[model samples]
Target: MTMSSLTFLDRERSVAGPGYSRWLVPPAALAIHLCIGQVYALSVFKTPLVARFGTSETAIAIVFSIAIVMLGLSAAFGGKWMERNGPRKAMFVSAVCFSSGLLIGSVGIATGQLWLLYLGYGFVGGIGLGIGYISPVSTLIKW
Candidate 1:
């Protein structure tokens, strides 16, 4: 977390130098934002999820609700940690969490477990979304 504790994903190595171009940062940020923004497409699966889970529409909606709520909370709380740790590390962590959440959700869907879906795509993935959403902000501002 500290400069002395920098690891492979640490931001120290990524620090823009005199010749660095700010243009590159926006593309990287946009790419990440685009990936994280897929959650906005959750509605596309709404009816299918409801049918697959044999649950009420409101129940299925909770999954998205949870994800959105987690996104807000994580972004609010994680912004500082993202800054302190640097975007490189934050992005890696976000990717891991988001991917893991998707895997977990897949298993849940196969096993027919609603809670797993809630825990995975909703909670875990949401954290990824939040961190990913905020990680680029600091870097963009720094430039």
Candidate 2:
């Protein structure tokens, strides 16, 4: 075949069959995850919590640390589940858990309840982070 024909065939193969649109999925996925990654921005709420609850910085920092540790643990344990369930479902669940944690944490701060912060931001939100992190990793590897 001519050089031109070879190039055309390559292009055809790249776009054909079970193959995806090379130009689309990556950026679309990145846009979504960028928004979701805001969970890691939890520190933004720390000052407000301290202001409302009059809690010590050490206490607040401990709360954040618990959340991070839980996140890591959940991801480690749930990575297989994420891969089996698919990224979209995993991401949706993660969003719900993460948001719920923040809301609960807000209530805890308003009421001066430290336990609520642990429940909301540490356990719930941590689970969300774990699931969200694993959800995309496998998908990208497969892709």
Predicted model with the maximum lDDT: 1
On residues 38-88, what C-alpha lDDT tens digit does candidate 2 reach at each position? 656767877876786688777777777888787789889888766565566
**How displaced is residue 42 in candidate 2, in Å?**
3.6
C-alpha lDDT of candidate 2 relative to the true structure: 0.73
Write the residue-wise lDDT of candidate 1 on 103-129 in tens digits.
Answer: 888888898898999999999999999
What's the lDDT for residue 4 in model 2?
55
Candidates in order have lDDT scores of 0.88, 0.73
Which whole-number lDDT from 0 to 100 does residue 131 have in model 1? 89
Clashes of each: 0, 0
| lDDT of model 2 at position 58 | 73
